[model samples]
Target chain A: MTVQEKSWKEIPPAGICWKPSTEYLTGDWKTYKPIMDSEKCTRCTLCVIFCPDGAIHWNPGKEDIEFDYDFCKGCGICANECPTKAIEMKLE
Target chain B: MFSEWKFTAKDIAEKADLFMSGHRACAGCAAATVMRLVLKAVRGPIIATSATGCMEVVSSIYPYTSWATPWIHTAFENVAANASGIEAALKILKKKGRIKQQRIDVIAFAGDGGTYDIGIQALSGAVERGHDFLYVLYDNEAYMNTGIQRSGGTPHGASTTTSPAGTVIPGKVQYKKPIADIMVAHDMPYVATASPHYWRDLITKARKGIEVDGPAFLHTFAPCPRGWRSDPSKSIEISRIAVETCIFPLWEAINGEYQLSAPSKVIALRPERKKPVREYLKMQGRFRHLFTPKFEKIIDEIQQLTDKRWQRLLKKCGIV
Candidate 1:
C-alpha cells in the first residue's frame, strides 16, 4: 500500500499505470453495509447484474452469492433491486 | 427476441473480469455498470480507448488502472480518432503476421460531453471513414465529471450548474441532441440506444455493435446520482423509469432501418403501458423546480414532447 517514489528519469513516458487498481480498498467509503438473507434468496442474479462495484459474486462451491466487502462501497443498489428483499442495508 | 444472446448470472460470473473494481467511480455510478456489461459482451481481446471523462478519470488513476485489458487514454475530443488509429494499426499488424489474434474488438468509451459536443466531429469522421470499431457513449445527461456543467445531451428541463433553474430560465433551454439518430445517418451497420436497467438488451446491442464489420454507435443512458441529485440506490430505478416514461426509449437501427427494442416495443404496441413523464421527472432533483406551480406548464410541455417523440419513433419503426 506504500507509494514508492521513483526518480523522474526512471518513470515511464505517458503516465503508464503498471499495477491493477485492486490494491485500493474502497470499502471504507461505505456508511451502510448490505447483508444478504440466504433463506429468501432466489439467486435470480438481479443484484449481481445491477451492482455498480462488481462486489457481488456467485460462489460455485457454496452455490450462493458472496459479497466482496473490500470493493463494495455499499451503494445499496443490490438491496434496492433485490426482488425477494433478501439483501438488507444495515448501518455500518 | 434476444433470447439466444441472453446471459445467465452464472455465465456473467464466469466471464473474465475485464473492468475491475477498486477504481474511483461513485458508489452507484451507472456508467461503471455500462462499461462492465460492454466488456462482458465483447468477451474477447479488446483494445479500449476512453475520452477524458468520468469513467476515464475514475478507472485510470496515476498509479493504477481498472481495465484488465489493454486500454489507451486519449484527450477529450479524440477517443474515436484514437480507436480508428488502433484498428488500422492492428489490421496492418495482422497482415504482417505480427499479432496472433483473429479479431480484436476496438471500443471507444466517451461521456455525453465528449460524444454529443466536444468529440462529435472526430466521432463523425471516424465512423464516416468505415473504421471497424464500436463507439459507446455513456450519456449521464450532463458534464458530470466537471461538477455538473450542462452539455448537449442535457434534457430540456434538467437544471445544471451552467444552466441553473431560476426566475428567468427553466434549467437547460435546449432538448437533448439525438446523437444516435445522427450516427444512424452515417449508414453504419449498427446503431442503438440502451440503458443500464436493461442490461440484457444493452449487452446484446454491445455484442452486435462489436461484431459488425463497419462502424457502430451505442448511445447508453447512464444515471448520475450526484449530478441528478437523486438517491444512489435509485440509479437503476431511474433508468428503468426513463424507459417506461418514454424519455429514453430503447431502439436500434441497422443500416438505417429503425426498429424499437423489446421494452419500447411493448409500449409502442400498447400505448397504455407508457408511464407519464411526471413519474420520471419527479424522481430526479434536477427537475424539482418543474413540479412547482410556476413551472407546471413546462411539465405538460415535456409530456407532450415525449408523446410526440414516441409516436414519431413508432412511425419510423413502422409500428404505428
Candidate 2:
C-alpha cells in the first residue's frame, strides 16, 4: 500500500444562519487577518476583552500586544472601538 | 428497587478519575460529563484532537489545563484531519516496529459547529479511508462556545441569538442535518447516537465502537444549560425530556442493520412535551420573547416535526 493518500479537499465553513444561537463564519478562516497597531495602542485591552476566541495577547515586558490571526474571527469590534487608530482589518 | 444495586470496586476502576472535580465547565455542561465518560472507556496511549468550542475552551484555558491525556487543539474545522495525521503517524510507526505496544487510538472530539457544519468533509474522508480511529460528535444543538451561536444541529422553531422571536417571526426555521444517516450512507463500520442522559446505553455504545475494527463515529446529544437557556439543575432532566419526547432517539447501526436501544417514552399530550421546552426556554435570557403567538407556533412546529420523526424511527426500528 502506498503511504501517499489523496489530498483532502478543504471543507467550507457553514455560512450565517439564525436558527442556532450564533452563525459562526465557517469556511477557511485563514483568509482574513486582524491587524493591530502597537504605535497607537493605549493598551486598555478592549480588543482582548471583546474577542470571543482569545486571539489577542499582551506582552508585559515589551508593552507590545499581539493578535494571533490563526484564531481571530475578524468580528471588527476591536477596530470599531479602538480608542486610538490601533487595530485595522485585513483580508489575507 | 433500583437503589439496592451498589457501585462495585471494579466499576470504579473502570470509571477512572480522568476529570477531577475542580475543572471549570459550565454549572451543568453535558459535554464535560461526556468527556469524562469517553476518556474512561479508552486506555493506553491515545491522542485526542478537539475543535474550538465550549469544551475546548473551558477545559483548556490558557495556563490551566483539565485533560490528563495528551490532547491537541487545532482550528474548528480540521479536528478530523488532525486526528488523521496522528493516526497515520501512529500506524506507520507501529508497522515499522518503531513504537512498542502500538495501541494508541486516535480520536477527535467536536461539537455541532465543528462536526455538522465546518468539519463534515474531512470527517467523511477520514471515515471513508477506513482509518482505525474514533470520532465523537457532542451535539449541544448549536454553537455554545461563541455565546450561543447557531449551527447546523440547531432544531427548527427554537429561538437563538440569530433567530429571535418577535410578533412577525419566531424561532429557528430549519431542521437539523441528519448526520448519522449521512455517516451510515458512507457504509462505515460503526455508527451510533447516544445521549449522556442514557449512561448505560452510551457507555455500551462507546465500548462497541472501541471494539470495532475500522472507523467508528458516535453522535452524542449533549445539552447545554447556558446556551439552551435552561436552569443549571435541569440539564439532566432536559436531556431526559429530549429522549422521552422523541426529540432524540438512542440507536445504533451496525453493518447497515438498525437497532434502537429503547422506545421513545410517550407522554400524555403536546403540552407535556411543551412544558420542558418552555421551562428550558424561559430560564434563558435568549428566549424571553417567546411569550407571543409567533413563538407559540415555533414550539408547535417543533412538536409536530419531532412526533413525525419519532414515528419514522419507530418504523425503522420495526416497532410500529
Candidate 3:
C-alpha cells in the first residue's frame, strides 16, 4: 500500500507510530531462500531461537518447524547453524 | 530467592511475539535476537525504552514499530532515566487505583555505545537510586548504528573506523572496560553478562532481573555482522566461540556474589577445554590484520590478556 501523503500538522505528535511493523513485508530483501529437509531435521529449534526476524515457527500440529517466507530475509542463518544440515539456502 | 523458569524451545515458540518480524534489523543481527529473547522471558505488561542505537532505529522506522508493547525511544544517554520515570509513574498510578495491573515490567535497552560510554551516567544514577527496572545492554562492542567506530567496550586488537588497524598501530589500544563489574559495584540485586548463543541462560537471567524488586543490569554480547565483518549466518557460531575462548564469559552476580554461568563455568573448571583466542578472532574480519606475521605479538598480547581476565574472573567467583 502506498503511504498517504500527509501535511506536517497531520502527522502524529511526538512521532508516534500507530501501525505494527508486521504490515511491512521484508521478504523482498531475499537473494536466497532457506529450504528445509524434514527427513534430516532434528527439530532442535535452534533456527527458531537464532532467527533475527522471528520468521521461523514451530507448527505444533505438524510437530515440525516451518518458515514464514513473508518476512524471512533469507539470511541463511538457519541453514548455516542447523546441526543436522536440514536447512539449505537456495537462490531465490 | 528466585525460582528458575525452565523454558523449552516449544514453550518459547508458543508464547506471544512481543518483538514482531518484518522490522528493519539486518539479517542475522544478534542484537535483534537479544531483544527477542529478553522480551520472551517477561510476562505481563511491559514498557520498553531503547537508547538511540541500531535496535531503536531499525525496529521503529517512522509509521511502523516492531514492538507490540509500549515502547519509548530516548536519546543516546537517557534510556535508563526514561525507564525510571515510567516505573515511577506506574507506581503512582497503581497506588492511586488508576492502573489495574498489579505489576508492570519496565525494561531499558541500549547498545554498548550508549551503555558503556554515552549513557553510563544515566544508567549508574538510575541503578544507584534503586529503580524498579531492568537495564539490558546489547553490546556489539562499537558504535555500530552510526558507523564502525570504537566504543569503550571494544576489545583490544579489534579494528573499527575510529581505531583502524595499520602498520603504525594495531587496533584498539585499550582493553574492554569492565562494565559488568562496574554495575556490580553499584550493589544492585541482580547483574548478569549473557550472550545470545545461550538463550536459556539469557532468558532465565532476564526473568530474574525482571522479578527482582530493585534494579538489575544485563550485559549481552551481540555480534554485528556488518560492523565485525563477519558472515551474517555465522553470528551464533561467533557468539559461541567467544564464550569458548573466554573472551566474553557468561556470568552473573546476585547481591554482589559472582558466579560463572554454565558454559563459562565448564571452561573455567577445565581450563584445557577452553579454545584459543585465535579461533575466535579468525572468524571476524575485524581482526584480519592481526593474523599477519608482524602483528603476531599483538595476537599473543590479546590471548595473554584474555587468559589473565579469565583467571581474574575465576578468582572473583571464588572458583580458584
Candidate 4:
C-alpha cells in the first residue's frame, strides 16, 4: 500500500510491513567501509551480536561473516570490537 | 572496569538497518541514535509500536518509515495498552491456527512524556497484567518535539522552555522522577537504564528485555542537542560524559536482583572514579544560567544529589 493514500489503513503510503528497512541504502552516509578478512577471523560472532545495525550476515556457506555495504553506516563498532582486528575500515 | 567494556562503533555498524537512514531526525540526535542501538537486537520478525513524540513524528510519516519491521504508530498515550492488545491478538491468532506468529517480538517505544506522564497508567496496567512485551523509554529529558518543555525525566536544575532560567529561579526546581526505579518497584522481571555510548550494554539489556517471557522496561538516556542547547556532534559524547560524571548511573534489576553496569560498577568500587558534575552541567545551555558564581550553590546541590544517588545504587548492588 502506498503511504500516499489519504486513508490510514496499511497501504503503500503507510510503508508498514512484516519486512525490515532493507530498501534504504545508507552506505552513502559513510566515508569508510569495513572490510572483513576471514583469514584473521575468530568467528566468535561478537561483531554480529554487538553490531548496532544488522549489516553483518553470518554466511556459513562462505565460513565467514559478510558485510552488505549497502546497509553499513561505517560507525566502526565492528572494527573496534573485533577481537583480532579482522575487520578494517577502508576509506571510500 | 572500563577496560572490560567491549562493543565499539564498528561492532554496532555490523548490525545496521532495523532503522535505516534517509529519515528526518536532526543530525546527531541522541534519541535517534538510541533508537538505532535498541532496534539492533531483534533477531526475528518483530512488531514495534511508538507513542507520539519525536521518534514517532520524525521516523514515521505517511508513505515513508525508517522501520524495516512491522510498525504501528499508536496515539500519544496508551501505547502499552495497544501493545498488550497486539500481544493478545498474536496469541489468539496462533491458538486459532490463523497465523504462525511464533517468536515475533512485541515492543513499545516511547519518549519520557509518553512514558513517565501520559502513558504511565497504561504502562502500569500492562505490566501488572504480565503482558509479554518490551517497553523502551527513549528519554531525551523534555518535550523536545514540542519545543523543549520540561518533562518528568528532565534532570534537576536543567533549563527548558517551560523551566526557563532567570533571576527568579535557577531552572527546573524538582529532580527527575526516578522513573526507572519506579519501574523496578513494580516487581517486574527486568528493568534497566542504558545509554547509547555503552552500545554493548545497551544492546544486551534491550535484547534481554524483549526476550523475557513477561514485561521488561528499558529506560535509555537520550540526550537532545536541541533541548539541551548543546553541540549536535557531541550527542554520543554527551551520554559518555553523563555516565562518567555518575549523574546518569546505569544499572539493571532482574527479579529484584540489582547489578551496576561495568562503568558504574567501577565507580561503586572506587568512589574516586566519580568525576565532578560541573563538566556535564556546564556543557549544556540549559544549565548555562548556573555557570555564574551566584548559582554555584545549585551546582553543589546537584553534585550532592549525584553522590547520594550513586551511594544508594552502590548499596543496592552490594558493592559498598
TM for every model, in the order presented, reads: 0.97, 0.70, 0.97, 0.80
List candidate 2 stretches off by more than 4 Å: A1-92, B1-14, B263-291
Error of 3 at B267 (Å): 0.8
Residue B297 error for model 4, in Å?
A: 0.9
Give the better candidate number (2 or 4) by lDDT. Answer: 4
Give the C-alpha miss distance for residue A33 in model 4, angstroms.
Answer: 16
Clashing pairs in model 2? A13-A26, A13-A27, A20-B150, A21-B149, A21-B150, A22-B149, A22-B150
Tens digits of per-residue lDDT for model 4, B1-320: 01222454445555546776545555446787678778877767889999999988876654456786778889889899999999999988888999865678899999999998899999999999999999999999999999999988888888888988888788999998988888888999999999877878898888888877899999998877778888654667678789999999999999878999997887777767788999898779899988887777999999999889888888888885
Off by over 4 Å in 4: A1-92, B1-12
Cα error, residue B111 of model 2, in Å, equals 0.4
Rank list by DockQ: 3, 1, 4, 2
lDDT of each: 0.90, 0.67, 0.91, 0.80
Q: Which runs of model 1 end up more than 4 angstroms from their true locations?
A: A1-11, B1-6
In terms of lDDT, model 4 sits at 0.80
Question: Every model's DockQ, to 2 decimals?
Answer: 0.79, 0.02, 0.83, 0.13
Say what the interface RMSD of candidate 3 is: 0.9
DockQ (0 to 1) for model 4: 0.13
- Docking quality tier of candidate 3? high
Pairing residues by index, what is the TM-score of model 1? Answer: 0.97
